[model samples]
Target: MRSLDFPALIYILLPEVFRIIELFHFHKQVNMYESQITLVMDTICPWTYLGKKRLDEALAQFRASPSSSSISFDLQFSSYQPSPSRPETIPDRAAHALHEKHNDNEEAQKLFEEHMISLAKPLNIPIAFTGPTGNSFPAHRIIQQVQESHGPEVTNKLVDALFRLYFAEGRHPGEDDMLIEACVEAGVGEKEAKDLVGDKTKGERKTKEDIRSIGMDIDSVPTVIIEGRRRDLTLTGLKEVSEYVKAMETIKKEST
Candidate 1:
């Protein structure tokens, strides 16, 4: 029943007021939208590699911008096989395969390579038409395993290493040596890398399931699907960095 002064009452309630404000902010953060980006691609595909690079650049730019302060992103890679029937190990016949795909037209193959090289030059990605071209199943399996065990950051590194190994270094995708080297480069221990590479059957079923899950809708590589709160955005093939940024902005707007 004792009377309290204004300053005493204010002091007594200040801590509770701060606590309430903290709770409010925490709730707001908890409810913030997260966009999930799934990149459906094949390791041997040059266009998918370019698409991944462009998407990475776009995500970096968007994260650095003021408008993306409240947005969160989760990027994941899905497996796709352009030539599912190719053997796990094959000789270096990429050029021949390209020519065959182009109906034995050398000019068409040359033009295709030239266009890819031009696009890659600006991004500093070395476009090579040489390397073992065959089944990418083992490579996809390793990627899926790494993603499951190490999460997205390490998986991204592994994917980048695999791309560089196959495209830039002209290494075989499904070879044990190549897989071990890529895993090591991505920060996986050498022993684990070897073990993972040794078991070719590991992650095979899941990888195949993932490929099948993509279904008939995505009949191409480098297809990116952005899952937003209200709607989803699908981007097929390689796109400019600005375009990816715009897509992120659109998702953010819809989220709010």
Candidate 2:
């Protein structure tokens, strides 16, 4: 009666051991890849979509350069909700743009749309803003869940899907079903993903705290940061491709 079952106790503690291994493996992969890039973005954000495309272009150029081919890239994602508490059931996007945060002026709406269209053209993003613009809190949770459970590559896939679904394709990220579909496409477990989306404020609270810790709060989406051994660079919104290239170059130089 005094002695406990050692084998049974070992099984009970196995999951925690696996979690430790997973964390170790993820960081191992990151170190192997050599660069740590964190993108803090909202899913339903148009400018973030453009930012993603721009970042991709910059990375392609950076990698194609003869001197930098040896440097591998690891893109980590952080969540940011500029306006997390907006209504989840808005049926129109343009109206959301006009009412939710922007002033309720007709001309302001037109300019927003016009600028979006111009940005969409370069990447050939088929965005019409024809449908609803739902709340972004759920999408952030899914991205964070994948990043924490899976890895940066898997998380990048989910973030890409969310942006494509919300901006290029005609789907609102606020819908649970759409988010579940996105998770599945990103190689996330469908069942577990639903549970993640159901829980609010899990991932984004830490993102908010992270931004605050650095003495700056997130006031916008698609904020990309390159952290190096000796320096760090930050960019917000749709920065030029050359600017992104410069950021990566700075990181590489500092890393060396």
Candidate 3:
């Protein structure tokens, strides 16, 4: 391409060229075709921990691909409580998981627990089902506040911390102090987290909107919904990394 000498060019042409430069920056700042992923999950869900690892792996693969490098992946997480009606605290989350997963089958319960353990081995992310179950509503609220003020990168950190506290540390999500500590460790200030800790109005509103945005009621945990490029993708429950890879590929094709 030949260089344009703006100083020597006519004033009218210079205005047009300036306009072109402005448009370039404008488009670069906002591209609607970029993938938008919304993960709806509860903090107590063990499989969600695994699903997140797989999604990260899939995204890493996408980032490495030359063709996909030009686009961006926008991630947002929504809150979903498995037992919404229950109080913020529960006696035994481990037993709950067993019953929910195996449906009272002892052999299947063992296998399910084993599967959860095995899923985290290769990813290097730890998870265990030996903790108490608590309402994830408050944690969800904190995430919502983080997402609003700090953006997705910080929000992701908070999410990882919450999952770590729940599964690896055996901490209950119902407690506000634990959530506040996790948030501070994840980059949120102590005062900021405490102020918004148990406040669920914003989180509940946004979560309902997120569910409506996906146009479906997510009954189970670990559900992922990706929107953009004329394609809407949803993956529920456990799946291989290859599955997420394929979904991204399909989205890339539709976008083209």
Top candidate by TM-score? 1
TM-score of 1: 0.88
Please list the Cα RMSD from the true structure of every candidate, rounded to 1 decimal place.
Answer: 3.3, 13.0, 5.5
Shift of residue 196 alpha carbon in model 1, Å: 1.3
| Candidate 2, poorest ten consecutive residues by summed lDDT | 207-216
- lDDT per residue for candidate 3 within 160-244, as digits (tens), equals 8888888898888868778888889888878877877756575667755554554357678799887756869989997899898
- How well does candidate 3 match the true structure in TM-score terms? 0.79
**Error at 28, model 1, angstroms:** 4.9
Query: Tens-digit lDDT track for model 2 on 81-176?
Result: 666567787888877678755789888778888888887788777776778777777676667668888998788888888888887677877788
Each candidate's lDDT (Cα)? Answer: 0.88, 0.77, 0.79
Candidate number achieving the greatest lDDT relative to the actual structure:
1
Better by TM-score, candidate 3 or 2: 3
- Per-residue accuracy of model 1 over 1-256 as CA lDDT, tens digit each: 9999999999999999999999988986887787889999899988998999999999999999976766788899989886688776668656656655787787888888899999999888897888676779889999999999999989999999999998898888888898999999999999999999898778888788888777557889899998988999999988999999999999999896
Each candidate's number of clashing pairs is: 0, 0, 0
lDDT preference between candidates 2 and 3, better one = 3
